[model samples]
Target: MKVRVIDNACRDFKNIDYTEVSANKICYRWQIFLEK
Candidate 1:
């Protein structure tokens, strides 16, 4: 499950702008996921 999330995140990341804001958003999302 975790791997799938990461894979999807990576794929999505590649399709979007690689900016600091986006990176932070992804990190924030992972933090939330980890908290759960």
Candidate 2:
């Protein structure tokens, strides 16, 4: 799975540590975001 942060601020943050985050974690967060 591929995830891209579309927000400018989030893009900056993603450039930092997001490379280390697992795909499953990203998917889990996406699921939570969609539920909100």
Candidate 3:
């Protein structure tokens, strides 16, 4: 049971990391566009 809980937590962390990376990429592109 403890192992299952740890696995779920790891998955959630990975998903959050992915979302943050995508957001950063979008923000970077917008910055470049505005600079032009």
- Which numbered prediction scores highest in lDDT against the true structure? 1
What are the RMSD figures for all models against the true structure? 3.1, 5.9, 14.1
Candidate 1: stretches off by over 4 Å: 1-17
Mind giving the per-residue lDDT tens digits that candidate 3 earns over 1-36? Answer: 554554554456556766766655655555555556
Order candidates by lDDT, high to low: 1, 3, 2
The residue pairs that clash in candidate 1, if any, are none
lDDT of 2 by residue, 1-36 (tens): 233432433455566666635544665666567556
lDDT of each: 0.70, 0.52, 0.56
Greater-TM-score candidate between 1 and 3: 1
As for model 2, its CA RMSD to the true structure in angstroms is 5.9
Winning candidate number (TM-score) = 1
* Candidate 1, position 8, lDDT: 73
Over 1-36, each residue of candidate 1 has an lDDT whose tens digit, in order, gives 776776677557757877767766785687578668
